[model samples]
Target: MPDAKPRLIVIDTDPGIDDAIGILLALASPAFSIAGMTTVAGNIGIETTTRNGGRLLAFAGREDIPVVQGGAAPLSRPGPEPLNLHGENGIGGVALPEPVRPPESLPAAAWLAEFLLDQPAGAVDIFALGPLTNIARLFIDNPDAARRIGRIIAMGGVVHEVGNVGPRSEFNLWADPEAAAVVVSSGLPLVLVPLDVTRRVRASREFAQALRVAGKPLASMVADLVESYFETKTHQESRPLHDPCVMLFALAPELFRLEDLHLVVNTGSTEEAGALTVDGNGTPVQVAIGVDGPAVLDLLARTLTAA
Candidate 1:
């Protein structure tokens, strides 16, 4: 019998193809119980992200989870125009059936505040896979509620690799640097799964074949999504499964080598927005600098196949 209680968590995401994988991975794992999902504007608009969340929960056969819509834009300035990398609907041209349910009526930030405040202090964790707009809003609207979270594991930035958006920006951080700054300064425990480690991992063709052969509806959907995403966006046959790394790391941190960094996000200066500056006195966030790629991919394969 399992001895430990499942960690209660909320996923804040934009539902990129990778985001779908991440959600499924977390759902399949035994260590977590997803309290809810909050959708924000990043890879796509809030409406589409909210729809994707509902569809994803339906796919995972966990429709009891509520999907809530959050901020449609950034904290201060506008985010970049939606990119074609995730397709028009943010799923790389693969379509899932329309969700049976709709998003919750309460706004994402408000719902999150209520949910977090209701939980015991340090009882809930958050996996943020999009722009930090919703997170910043939590701090702004209910700063006390933010303290209830155990930790935040965010997927953003590029320390060693060249930025995918600007010379210094990853898409998520670039989408809302001001929001990132707010979250960093909110005095919460943050773990960043940045591009430096995520880039080191890729989804192999074997795993794609395995997903296709699994024959389950969700597996088939994931296979199609992965195929389309890699073919359309990547130069290599394999694509970086960025978001799933965060899920894997949460389940087993021993698979990763982390470094504690006192960091600050550059929220001003268009040229420098989203840039991460390391300083001895900046807010502390643990950054994954190395990961066991094979182990993570193996875990992903097992989770998707089992789900």
Candidate 2:
């Protein structure tokens, strides 16, 4: 008999440190069938994010997953400089061995459309951990196909917390505000995991230290990555594993509290790019507002350590 079908998750990402953690968690778990991954420019350029994603798959011994290169810049705004927070090479500069596999021939947007369009409706769930460039492009080019997506769980924006990139914006949406605006208004079922709740979930140094003592290579690598992320912060003693939270919530939404709200992304104002506005009568989306932070960290540590 053929293997049972696990839920298909297609990730559109920029492989920052947290992104690496999220990918690894998905690979470790048995509930997900990673249909494919498409890289976009956000934490870094598409070239580097694509390479890093390939390396990550190799690191997890799952190189069969198709990786595709997506947009290099935003639709309308000039791209931001690859921030140093993720180190020079996006995963805190920890050298992952070169991947034996290369990305797909078609650009990410094209590949995503072809794959999702061919699948049965609601067969694919998109986990977007970076800029919405590739996703917005797909929605624009093929609205009918885009609507067939089961759901989209995106890690971006800010509900009540202060922004990470600018005074009013988070990095992923800010990197491509025009794309984000399109996505939020696309009427696709989107669940926004903003910085509001993500910042509350912190993986502490003690947990990382314990992981470093694990006898596995992946656990050691995770420890190093977590430590490097902590090092980038001057004020915080613990690090927020942002992208992994998105994966976790996708796997189990009951773990977090969500609110339905109509949202709009500010794409027109250069000075206020990526500012998210919530209104009673706007584009509807679900926002994750509360999470069991300690439970999540425990789950993350256990999962990565076991993997």
Candidate 3:
């Protein structure tokens, strides 16, 4: 019998530390059957992110899942070389074997389009944890496939809180605001996990210690990475689990408050490159306003620690 879960998700990401946690949580949970994962450049370059995706899957013993490389740079933007947020390798300086499985034959955008088309109508949910370049490209090339996707749960933008990359923009959207503008305006059902809510959820020392004691290798690694990242940032005592929050929305909608509103991305303004400006007039996309942070942490710890 097929799984009764309502979601067939495709992860489009740049495997930063939080992205690694998000992927583990999704793969660990029975609520989702991750169909495929496509990598893009964001926290790091496409090459590193792609390699990190493969490394993560291998670490989770999910080598069977295909990891395809996507766009190396955002549309109309210069390529962003890998950042050091997740250490040199984007995995907390932890080294792992390269994936035995090669990427899909086609580029990520084409592969994503093909997969969405092959799935049953409204069966696929896109979990975009990085820039929107690949997704935007996919839509441009295959409008039919774009329409087939059930919804998109993205981690970007800043409605009520300060943006991470700049005063008005977050890293993911800042990487390619034009692409973000296209995706949000496409009228697709979107569940946005903006910084407003994500900023409020923190992974504290207590949480990190608990994760380390959980006895799961992945959980321990995640904890270490979070701890390291937390040290570098202003909020050293508490770090936002930004990317994973998007996956948590998919795994447990009850953990958050969803408000449907119209959202726009600021691509033209130099001062607000990746700003996710919400339309005052009610729009149709679902935006996450609040989240049960403690509950989410518990869920993440449990899932990542499970044998």
Candidate 4:
């Protein structure tokens, strides 16, 4: 670990297979000091994701960190049925030990609001690894706290790559277009890690071998889970690691090309809801356009193996 100051972060997540990878990455890296995790509804419901957060933390031996349960659904419209892409329990069906600790008593927004207010201006960054519902509500329900945030490093939206949901929608934003709209329009500082860049940085089928060779508990467990994920995925040669890439950017923003753009989300259209459009009149934010894929893959592999 370098002697540099650690970045204090609050992770907003919905723990799927990739989400598990992302959270573990952060915990492994010495560059970040995770304040806590706020769980939202995405790959699964609040119940499963909240539980999964605790399980991941316990597995990582960081049970001291709190897992605060966020919104069960989006701002408006019913959320898509819990996705099976992550497996029945939303962590690739790998059975981690039940968490010895439970979730925080305060709801996601309230805890986030208090945490934000207590911190100095721009003291803590937010890694939004899931849908924007909890984050959007923080801006809507607590504007003062929202104003003090350092930045929102999010993994959603897609510029050049095809959408994961509809023709223009990614799963996170599509899960709650209304919330995405609110966050985009709120004028908070944001760095978006969309599919355009995440698709470029991936783990191949060989990643499992690397993890297994490391022989560390975290690495070995992730290896088993990822191999399970590979069973259902295409192109086993290259698996786009979405959430982990977002966390990586937080550690090394210099590795990516971030461009400031006025971006908008589609809340009015049914088919194109959550679609991100580059509009001059939209909110100005930093969008990651390019990255050194090989460098990122190397760093991730080195970290996970050493973790």
Query: What's the true lDDT of residue 221 in model 4?
Result: 75
Q: What is the TM-score of each candidate against the true structure?
A: 0.96, 0.95, 0.93, 0.97
Q: What TM-score does model 4 achieve against the real structure? A: 0.97
* C-alpha lDDT score of every prediction, in listed order: 0.86, 0.88, 0.84, 0.89
By the lDDT metric, which is better: model 2 or model 4?
A: 4
Q: How many residue pairs clash in each candidate?
A: 0, 0, 1, 0
The better-scoring model by lDDT among 2 and 3 is 2
Off by over 4 Å in 3: 1-3, 230-235, 280-283
lDDT of 1 by residue, 110-129 (tens): 99999988889999999999
Over 145-189, each residue of candidate 4 has an lDDT whose tens digit, in order, gives: 998999999999987667988888898999999999999889999
Candidate number of the best lDDT:
4
Ranking by lDDT: 4, 2, 1, 3
What CA RMSD would you report for each candidate?
A: 1.5, 2.1, 2.2, 1.4
| Predicted candidate 3 versus true structure: per-residue lDDT over 1-307, tens digit per residue | 9867646789999988889878878887778888889999988888889988998888778988899999988888785556777887886776677887888889998998888878788999999999999989988888889999898899988877778778878888888998888888888778888898888678888888988887778788777777777656755678788999988887788989888777778886585898877776534578898888888877788877884
Q: What residue runs in model 2 are displaced by over 4 Å at the alpha carbon?
A: 1-5, 232-235
Q: What value does the lDDT take at residue 198 in candidate 1? A: 89
Q: After superposition, how far is residue 68 of candidate 3 from its true place, in Å?
A: 0.8
TM-score-better candidate, 3 vs 4: 4
lDDT-superior candidate, 1 or 2: 2
